[model samples]
Target: MGLGIRALIMVFMTIFTLTSVANAAEGTATFYTPPYVPSSCYGYQNNGVMIAAASDAIWGNRAACGRSYRVRCTGATNQGVPQPCKGTSVVVKIVDYCPAGCQGTIDLSQEAFSAIANPDAGKIKIEYTQV
Candidate 1:
């Protein structure tokens, strides 16, 4: 190949790799108010406010405990908060499980949720990746 074409191919390859690493799972999030103890994973130990509960989809049958995820608010899931995202992300440790009938992919503690979105949003669209 010509030198120019080879450079172009390399540039495309770099862009592709970068995009792959940046990809995150899209999901919904809801905030759970405290009394954040007696958790299924820790059992009454305080894991602090920057914690979340994984839904059944990500729970991995209790293996999710102690895992950390970086969650970013993508947008509002309901009309109640049309612009609820706070334009930031929060990292939270998995401290519990959000069992069956859970409304979101991850249930963030109220403090964690408010760090990335308006509390009034209640539930919001999110992009998350294990960190």
Candidate 2:
């Protein structure tokens, strides 16, 4: 194959990968402070920006530890402290697994959470893509 064709193939693959990731993430989002037991797949931390996802069929155990994703809150809140969505997005590292009975698809650290949302809003709808 020619160099130009090979480059085009690589670009197409990248776009396809990103599109798949974006479509896979469509659920609720919330934030939290750490210091929990067993730590996360990347070990423990009480501060800094990060996020967690469920260890279900969607994201396998410890598989997403070092990955980053761009998350965007897509709508206005109807719950505690209304934070109207501004379509802003933030990239966060995956550091842990979602807590049992957690209320969202992804749980972010306060720093990561505040990047795309107002601090007062406890939960919001979000769409994310791996980066």
lDDT of each: 0.93, 0.70
What's each prediction's clash count? Answer: 1, 0
Tens digits of per-residue lDDT for model 2, 35-115: 532456645453254555543423566787767788888864574556656657888777678756877778877767787
After superposition of all CA atoms, the RMSD between model 1 and the true structure is 3.5
Q: Write candidate 1's Cα lDDT for 32-83 as tens digits.
A: 9989998989999999999999999799999999999999999988765579
Which predicted model would earn the best TM-score?
1
Q: Pairing residues by index, what is the TM-score of model 1?
A: 0.84
What value does the lDDT take at residue 80 in candidate 2?
53
| Highest-lDDT candidate | 1
